[model samples]
Target: MLWPFGTTWRPMRQKIRGTVDLRWLTARSWTTKWYPQGIDLGTWRGRRTLAVSWFRQDRMRRHVASRIAFVDLERSRHLDVALAIEGDDGELVPAQIHAGGLAWFGDRLFVAATGQGIWEFDLAALRRVRGPIARRLAGSRGRGWRAVALVAVRTRVHPVALRCSYLGRVFDDAGEPLRRVLIGEYRADENGRIGEFVVPGGPDDRFERVDLYTPGIANMQGAVRWGDHHLVSQSDEQRAGVLWSGHRDSLSRDRIPLPIGCEDLALDLEARLLWSLGEHPWRRVVRGIPFAQLGFDA
Candidate 1:
């Protein structure tokens, strides 16, 4: 069993028993087009597929017309555009999904837009079925509501959804109360740069403090679940890094060093490897690090 400096995993068995070699299996580049900020690996029709959202320009005109697409993992090909938001005249509009936080649940894709709130798309229909516009609270307190981070949890009834924000609220799938996480009192430094307060997990099971990596900034770009802990990618305008934490009430955190220039992350636990999706040309890269190498026993 590989144990980190401060965290532990049960069963304590080493999943990958030998030294792991990391390599890039394939690379797909986008010409001038921008890929969405998030990616997830799942089996579709018995084949592994990489589902991704489309990126949009920051200008207002471009923001209202964006599209989302998916890539087939096994074949290393891009799938057709799965979902597109359009204006009343039927022109495609851009969704405000930030870089690296899209999620897939069951046969659906969920994305958070700056103007559209939380949008849910059905895989079969390739259309958005619902959005969480009403549930969006007013953007105040110097936080931007335009960005969102999502984690999907499976439940007996249906898949439960959890979302985080630049401000500090965690919401359920229906935009209901999961818990309000306190990120600490925000204050400006001498240079007027904002410094975030370090608050750990609260009593609520739905919310956990996640600022150890990117300290004051509240941008949690992406996350992947491995056993009981979730490895998260957090970044600001200049730097990016990774952090891990067990689900709420456990309060175990392990911060790991990620390869530089990694914009998004996905985990293949069965293979004991981690994948990184880079920006711009949108190349898919793989780094095989043994589970034990990460300081956790199998």
Candidate 2:
């Protein structure tokens, strides 16, 4: 049988690290309604922070909207942050969309709001608020409400044009910041695509480049480009996920087995760790794999 991307799976070459179990937050109807989808790491107020986006589902499992979990590694505490936008009356209202993926750039978190566009939230502007929206996924009864991260900006992409599934950052040759974010789709078709765009840049300078994988990987959940090689995660609900490494030519590529429901990728070049998360119901975690094991000398 032919695989869609004509890709081959290689034996696992690396062991995962920094596993943070997310199953402990199963109180109320939270886990039953929302499932994890994306993960990224960054510094918040001088503390190392990990953020995971969760898309909410109704009783029938239909996508309802999304929220974000801000994890403080040192404290081993996770705070549910509600995603919201400013309404016409200047009131903060829920930004209803599947927050498929998240990429942390400085204090801004780029969220892949599938079919809507990339939504940017400022970490410095996080505010504590009380309401039904905030308490919906609080995980604890002590807190009547949760925190809210307002949308600072939204670079809209026509639904048909690009339904972003995941986001990654691009660095210069010296690994210096490029101020650009990589956006990718989750289409299972032959023409699945990914693109690089400038963050907080000019209107005409949005899209830097777009690439379509001819024999595209089905259910591509996350993707990131480092130097000449591209690392991507593809998921199949029935089996374990796969992390594929390839180049622009698509001539030589290899894959390693990932946990079932692996959803997004975030690179910590300084620590030489590649972070991702499992999205399966009741069995979810945020973990990292070292760069050396992934064949990255940098």
Candidate 3:
């Protein structure tokens, strides 16, 4: 799929149909320390939900640890949950990775852990806790006011350990049984790569049938498919982003303007909205853009 050359590319403001703030800045001190990376929409415990992954920024502003924010759409309430892994002695320890992207499937939540591969967390294991008590007992410090933590039950390591900067699930009309997750790598000066990996059915099974492709666009933060076109987002840190719409195999495309700090992408067809989140602090928001506004036919 390619956007023909000479096609007029116009600049238009994207209309936001809905949005929810992270609510950590004014609520706690550790607010700005954590930056958003990925987002996904799904159901948990019979409730419609949205989840966003965040990484803790250290003194040098590098990502060191991560957590997830779960939003209950019905109640308009949100809960912060730290991602953890079990220690040698059955103790829970923080999962140290930049939880860059999130894809929720069934009762499992898949998190992109940069060079560490993908971490599969159990949604059913999500539990509430007091901040003060959890910090002492579970060594869960620096979480600010988060009331929940979810431990990783398994991690499927990618063969090449590609920089898993963002992720999105594949929607195939062929209806094949294989479930695939789309992995994205971010590059500053060069074009980024995207890969498709088949999700294993069981804990013992490994991710197979890995297929990689290049979208021929640099600085791509996230991507989602609509019909035959790929809606790719390219950003330069805090500057406004460009939304590229074109064929998956063609380098030519039309660029649409987006707000600054755009990170990951998720498409909700039922609601006809494209979900995206901001990365920088103070301006962070989980917002939805309608399909019509993205130049897609309704």
Candidate 4:
């Protein structure tokens, strides 16, 4: 469960061998290089695979673009570049999405595209039909749907979805407003815009809202669901590295060290590892941390 990091922490036997090394890949040489903001591991056609999304910035125009890429976790090699989705073409189709987070539920991939909206991609279709579906609620405009963190809910049949946001409101499966919990401080009137909403829901139009985050956090960056607990991470202009836990009703006002400066986070559930990407020119470095040693325990 733990790896030796100098003399700071004790070493726990690892099931997988080889030191953790981050490999960088590029499709083109732009001013901004792509970074791995989020990742998901799952099985398809009896083969294990890894899915990743990129955070990019256009130095010339100062514009930002988010793209999705996949690699074989079993093989640890990048997937065919053609299959990866960039900007609106991938999960955030029809919208200019900047992916902030990602998670897996059953065989489906859920991605959080800050400002644009959340998307649910069919893993089977990615290999079968080569496309995903954007599950938009009726009359919903995808407002505050960005900055999403997805968690798997325990239930019968398929897993449920849980989403949180930088803005206040949380939602159930039907996109109905749910209660809110504390995230952090807010600046603008709409700074507390809801980014993601997660709750217990079923396939038959039945859903229930469980927990929510209150407005205040300017921008929610990263989130992870461990067992029944949810850890949300954020940063601000004054301070950086804020972590909040929904399952424990706790928050860390102090900043923590992050591999990259991003509002998004990804978790490798099986390995109990966390992954983050840095900003544009520095996107080559992907940071990995152990979940068991986050220091915020319930």
Candidate 5:
């Protein structure tokens, strides 16, 4: 079970005789104005716009410029337009998938699937071409593999895909049970060949289950590559939310002040703001918190 993680208008038209040539929507209706503040960048707008992509600053937009892709969980898909930062105006590209976590590696978009695996969407094609299922993920006790949240962390050691699992039982290659839930770090080199999997079992496997989930504890629902660390958004069913900041070693963790729970987090180093996605009736997909305050940037 992965957590974390939400429109439109028409214009008037005029018809000409015979063939009936039509002129659409008023200029005011087609016009887009970005509020200087983060006011209009939320679900409050309802159908205007919701979330922005975190890959805008990534160095992979050669042929196509970056786009803000919004992943709709219930709908089981995502939307990619030309640009949202400027305003939602461009071609609307829709892709099918149960998107959990999202990250951009080069030109491919990786979306974590709840307990399914990872989905790789091609930017050029603007659709889901493959969902390479890692049936036997590292540190599994035999429950296949579920990806709750995923991020491409650029660590001092290597650039790795850090993902969190939501499975209750872990499994190995041959489907042998090991433990319950595995926080894994899988790394591939710059060339993109398969690499190592390091499963950190919270110091002890026997107590991992109990230790990872306490009263105030939450499951990782959203993750982002913030600076040299992974900014993870954890949601507590009762409480507000918690955010963890770390790389290989646990640097620090903090509680989100708002009572609203945060799902997937997107940090724009260029914009210097961290956007946290809200749960259920999706909200706050655009409005952001200070990156410096969150300790995700310089």
Candidate 6:
């Protein structure tokens, strides 16, 4: 086993399947444009689905297209409906690109961008929905760094403080936070298009900088909130997936192996299933493990 972390795969019911689309291999993050980034259990077009965020659209060839496709999770044989987000101006092509972590708050879906600020959309219409939102979160000089996962909880989900009950994270592909792995908790701000990240992990639980991953956990991808904790998917190149679970303040935590480079994670708590999504789901998707099998009780 090449894995230096824990080898004992926790006992949980596992189910794996994928939609056999003859499309090219895409839907990953920090590696290719076809790579997908985030996953969530929500409704699309008024139908329940396993929502997955694609970095850029793969119209056989990669281009400037962003999307949030769906998998029919409620059905016995799930259907994959891949739709590139269209502009509100009535154009049928993708209006934006470079999408990352996604979270739903009220009537809007908040999407993290690599360079752009968070993009909001009205799920039912499948169109770009921008609100009259602006905040002096970072004054004139804003942080244009790339962002990853997000969490918009009604209450403080984890043992952390919050400004607006909405927390988001940004990634560093420039190799700045890779060695130390910036694991800090930031407050919610309206610094749109991949909002600015500020350090506010509090005094006792503050983690301005923490040394995580001695050998590194590949390129940091996307994440999702599980109960009071967050599970971050660390892409092992583009072949395998490693999941790192912990609170924002806690860095050194559990490393659970997953299939393909799961750009994001979605937990179906009712079924005790952990939906680990990767790129190339149009071709194949490897599913495994339950949320409880990770040795953590919810």
Best by lDDT: 3
lDDT of 6 at 120: 48
- Candidate number with the higher lDDT (2 or 6): 2
Question: Candidate 2: how many backbone clashes?
Answer: 0
TM-score, structure 2 vs. true:
0.78
Q: Against the true structure, whose TM-score is highest?
A: 3
Model 2, span 204-277: residue lDDT tens: 44454544453366788887777766788888785777888867457233455666778998777777777777
Worst 10 residues of 6 by lDDT: 131-140
lDDT string for model 1 (1-298, tens) is 1112221212211122243322222232443334435555556666665555445443353432234434444444443342343456754333444423344544645454433223455554433221332112111123343432122211111111222221222333333322222121111221111111222223232223343332232444444444334444443333434444455324343555443434445555554555444444433233334556566455
Question: How many collisions per candidate?
Answer: 15, 0, 1, 15, 13, 13
Candidate 4 C-alpha lDDT tens digits along 23-45: 55443222343444555455644
Whole-model alpha-carbon lDDT for candidate 2: 0.65
TM-score winner between 1 and 2, please give it.
2
User: Comparing 3 and 6 by lDDT, which wins?
Assistant: 3
Candidate 5 on 1-298: residue-level lDDT in tens?
1222212222224332321112212322122211000111222113222233322111332212123434332232234332211115632322222234444433333443333344333433322111221111111123433422122111111112334221112223333333322222212221211112222333231222222211122355544332234455566654666776665245357743422444555444434555554432222223356656664446
Instruction: Give the Å error, residue 63, model 2.
Output: 3.6
Write candidate 3's Cα lDDT for 133-240 as tens digits.
Answer: 345223335565553333334444544356778888666543222367778898885667887777778767866746678877788888766445667778767787
**Residue pairs of candidate 2 with colliding backbone atoms:** none
Q: Which lDDT value does model 2 have at 251? A: 27
Residue 165 CA displacement from its true place in model 3, Å: 1.5
Error of 2 at 15 (Å): 11
Model 6 scores a C-alpha lDDT of 0.41
lDDT of 5: 0.32
- Candidate 6 clashes: the total is 13
Name the TM-score of candidate 6.
0.52
Report every candidate's CA lDDT: 0.37, 0.65, 0.66, 0.41, 0.32, 0.41
